[model samples]
Target: MSWRTARRICRPTARRRRKAQWRKAVDAVAGGIERASAC
Candidate 1:
């Protein structure tokens, strides 16, 4: 298969992984901010 085909096949999985990481990072930052604000 060509690189374009491979990329198309992998794109969704990569996007999901990235979204999970982004959500985790955002949640962590939000949690930290909440704690800091509570003080």
Candidate 2:
């Protein structure tokens, strides 16, 4: 397969994985802040 075609196929899932990772990181930080405030 050509390089451009392979990249196009892989791009969407990679983007989605990065987005999910970012969301998880944000949630963890928010949870940590809430716990700190509660203590």
| Candidate 2, 1-39: lDDT as tens digits | 699999999999999999999999999999999999999
Regions of model 1 farther than 4 Å from truth = none
CA lDDT scores, all candidates in order: 0.98, 0.99
lDDT of 1 by residue, 1-39 (tens): 599999999999999999999999999999999999999
TM agreement with the true structure for every prediction: 0.92, 0.87
Instruction: List runs of model 2 lying over 4 Å from the truth.
Output: none
Candidate 2 pairs with clashing backbones: none
Candidate 2 has its poorest 10 consecutive residues by lDDT at: 1-10
